[model samples]
Target: MRGTGLAGPGHRRGATPHRRTISILTLVGVCLLALSATQTASGEPAADTVDTGFAIPFAGAPGYERLAPTQVTGPDQLNQPLGQQAADEIAGQVGLNRADALSEEQYRDLVAGGGVGGSREAAEVIDACARILTNTNGRPLYSHVDGHPTPSVLASYGLYVNTSGLLESPANADAPTRQVNSLIAPGGFVGTWLRNNGATHTLIALYRSAYTVQAVYGFAAQQISGAAQLVTNTREGVSSEVGMSMAPPLWIVNFALLYILNPSLAAAMPAHWAPIPSAVADAIRSSATGQVPFSDYAPYFQ
Candidate 1:
């Protein structure tokens, strides 16, 4: 595999020892900080509307096919929380919720061993990523301040505000900016997107475990889902009251769309992190859904 690790301004995730036995809930808590996702079309909060200037150009670019997926006719604000809204929008034959979420049951006859490997293999990558995600753009990934809009305590159980440049605005809105509106758009960040998209696969090099490629990739894929799901769910759940959304929200309808729409995400993924099972990639590239163009992400297939 092409061995260039995550490329960006900073690239040194402390290699954490493999975590052999992390409960799903514990793993969720550990990874909740370093993740992010796009926002759903419906009920997109006034604060999170994407800047069309940057997003429009991206939509016109080679890969993006349509802003709204085939299933969504248009923006219809629904009561469902952000995470569930995104999941529902991307389900059916049109999406890969099971694959992206790393549901082992979905593996069927596709992979050898659930494709995720043992617990230690997955934990090493998770710990490495968590160390890098402790904070982004200088703001704590998890807000310790508590109160409305901004909190005064570690409020909301553990569901705190995500001020990272990934989902929220960067610390310096006036700084020289890139056309990354697609990455941070339709989120609280209206001006700029500057957070680091942690590439979990890069850790393979640090750990020197080329053999664990599949496990690393599987964990990374789950991280993408977790990052987006947790960030979207927790951030959108913020209210006058201090509490967590038992159910998080979602940004994009399909998880695959986020990779295409946000080049920054592509930059952060594994060099060889392809469709976990050939089927998912085929579906995304087949032109069947008519949501995104395979041309937009041709390199991924190759």
Candidate 2:
């Protein structure tokens, strides 16, 4: 079970505590503002896409032969340090005092909580990240925004928009600006790829408890199915919307290729032949179906 202390001030169900530090350069907000501006120029309104299309990544697939048993647990063990880094970065960029957002102890509490991200406070932190990912038109790489983009709001939290050298135009218009073109190509697929490999594992640490680990991992395996279904559904959606008869959407290709190539996910071996109990596996299946928060299993963490 979770420790029996005060459980900390930032330990609310949906909010993460604010860290008082910031980064040397407040780039995240700048980039978001820039993107918001560009998106506005494009004139496509904010996103109202169906939530059904937004799926957990690892739903169902084959050839997950490399996923370690430990990979399935909560992300806290690995993410605690990174989250702190993010918090610190926010603090430095905004030049705000830490006491206003998060104290050291409260920050630690949030990191220990595996970034479950559903609370009102958590929204503030995530909103900063979202602003960074979005374009000037209030659209994210994958979705549109509903309100005026708020790049300034998250500045206090260490999220800056760092376009830095990206604004430089290329020598020729026929050739694209390498930096701007990069974001246009895919939706953080490269980052996701890095995360899938062992690079992000250290930052997204596992839960120490055996059961919590199992449940968390089990849920991830099921994301393969969900991702697959999304591809099938999206193919039809895109075909009807743009009137383009292109082959499969790039997202399908990206997800499918990554599923097969992710050696760690392959190793997870979600099939029935695995030695883990059916009941435990069933729990994971249910959790995925319901979009259950993995932090619910936090009490079992060792």
Candidate 3:
């Protein structure tokens, strides 16, 4: 008999075997991509299937309209759990202690003290422990010095935000929204307003005394403090790990709270790469439109 490895009589004349393999693989990729897109996040697609289409998650710039401190957050931005309010209320009672630092009993007592959100299910308790962080000194993380957010503070997030440009930049020929947004009074809310409809959460977190600020910060500090990075949320008395979340490299992350609360600090803020005002505005618009904005600004910080 002929060698078994020899080509079979049914082999096609012109098409190479590898060509058939390539065609099948290409078809498979297309079908998988379509399936991945159709499935909800709960479907939990395979890593290879999911990674092929997803963007890396990170904070993008706030919108031009949101910078105004007046516009309300649409529904898309307010997806927190029903219990988040209770969680914050409990947090307010605990003051600045990291949720885990407290025993389950202490946590419950704190919740009871607030007259809100009782003991969470054992499984849900972990998330309940989660709260907005604080500065290294463990004080209120979002306090503002009064008048407005600082220009340099906004610039770090790529806004070039100033009282004059709260809604848009001044006469900067380089900024995209200069013409239209410039003349309008800034009507958009910053802070949680950028991500939700929690009006005055920013002020409630900032102007409130230490305990109240801690409560609000426990609820929504990331959207409020550090302009977005570093120091972690820990008071001098707590364990270093208790509240410190998201310790982005201090080298790249400027201390935004320094200027956000005290606009005067912007005067001393050393320039890193200038944030692109147009890009920031585009990010804001994208968020408003329910699209993901390009968040990879590592190069700008560099």
Clashes of each: 21, 59, 11
Give the best candidate by lDDT.
3
Model 3 C-alpha lDDT per residue in residues 1-302, reported as the tens digit of each score: 00000000122468676874564345435534553454332212224211111011111111111111111134221111213233333223222112213334433343343213232332122121111111111111121124433212222222222223232211122222121122111232122221232223333432222221121121122222222211222233431210012211111112122112222221222222122334443443344321221224223322
Q: Which candidate is the best by TM-score?
A: 1
Kindly indicate the candidate among 1 and 3 with the higher lDDT: 3
Q: How do the residues 38-100 of candidate 1 rate in per-residue lDDT, one tens digit apiece?
A: 233222222333322212111111112222222112223111112434433433212222223
What's the alpha carbon RMSD for model 1? 21.8
lDDT value for model 1: 0.22
Instruction: Please give the lDDT score at residue 43 for candidate 2.
Output: 16
Off by over 4 Å in 1: 1-57, 60-80, 83-86, 91-101, 104-142, 146-254, 257-302
Per-residue alpha-carbon lDDT of candidate 2 for residues 1-302, written as tens digits (9 for 90 to 100): 00000000112354332321121012223323433443322112223322322122221111111111112133332111123343333222222223233334433333233232213443333222223321212222221112222121111111111222111001111111112222212233222332443334311221111111222222222222321111121323531110000011111121122122221211121111111122322333354331212223212221
User: For model 2, what is the C-alpha lDDT against the true structure?
Assistant: 0.21
RMSD of each: 21.8, 23.8, 24.4
